[model samples]
Target: MTTATIAKPWYREFWPWFLMAGPFLAMVGCFITIYFAFTQFSNQPIQEEGLVKRGLVIEQQGAGAARQAAVQSKP
Candidate 1:
């Protein structure tokens, strides 16, 4: 009688690397996102248009609240 044994490398199997790739890529993506988030910030002053945009937003919010109050007061 003869017996034979086969030795296989771990990376030759599909499942282990497949399972690992997801979190490995996710961690890489996380680090990239964090790097961009931290490094991309700037201290430049807001443009004049941005201030006007904020004022318009505030006006719209006040108008919406007044409309809501008027509707609620009716019934």
Candidate 2:
């Protein structure tokens, strides 16, 4: 009887190459995507005036004046 040789897979054969390559490819892809995003962002600059900035602005009208007004305005 002849002994059969085990055939390795393409991925298995390429495992070390993939091990070194996978992260490198991912990093390159990430940088490319980031560059594209930044380029698009820079190309179309955001309009500060058009955007609806949702928040609150509490100006102290004046504590003494506010107190006087509250007292005067009370029914």
Candidate 3:
């Protein structure tokens, strides 16, 4: 006994596969783009360690000022 398969109509055929796969492929492309962006950020050389340390110091000083303000605000 031999079996024959029925062919699907053209409009019903490959379009659904594209719709299903399109978003998945687009997401993968987006992931690749984000990965390259992060890599670029990581690759840039920080020219001055002193500048980085000063930034940290400024952040800490700002946090300390906020704490002082909160303490002074309490009755």
- Predictions ranked by TM-score, top down? 1, 2, 3
Task: Judging by TM-score against the true structure, name the best candidate.
Answer: 1
Q: Cα lDDT of all candidates, in order?
A: 0.70, 0.71, 0.70
Per-residue accuracy of model 1 over 1-75 as CA lDDT, tens digit each: 898889789989999999999999999999999898678843333345224234235222445677899999996
Off by over 4 Å in 3: 1-12, 43-75
lDDT of 3 by residue, 36-59 (tens): 988877655344523333333522
| RMSD, candidate 1, Å | 10.2
**Which of 1 and 3 is ahead in TM-score?**
1
Name the 10 consecutive residues with the lowest summed lDDT in model 1: 50-59
Q: How close is candidate 1 to the true structure, as a TM-score?
A: 0.47
After superposing candidate 2 on the true structure, give the runs of residues whose Cα lies further than 4 Å from its correct spot.
1-14, 43-75
The clash numbers for all candidates, in the given order, read 0, 0, 0
* Deviating ranges (above 4 Å) for candidate 1: 1-5, 42-75
Reference-based lDDT, residue 68, model 3: 93
Q: Estimate the Cα RMSD of every predicted model relative to the unseen true structure.
A: 10.2, 10.5, 9.3
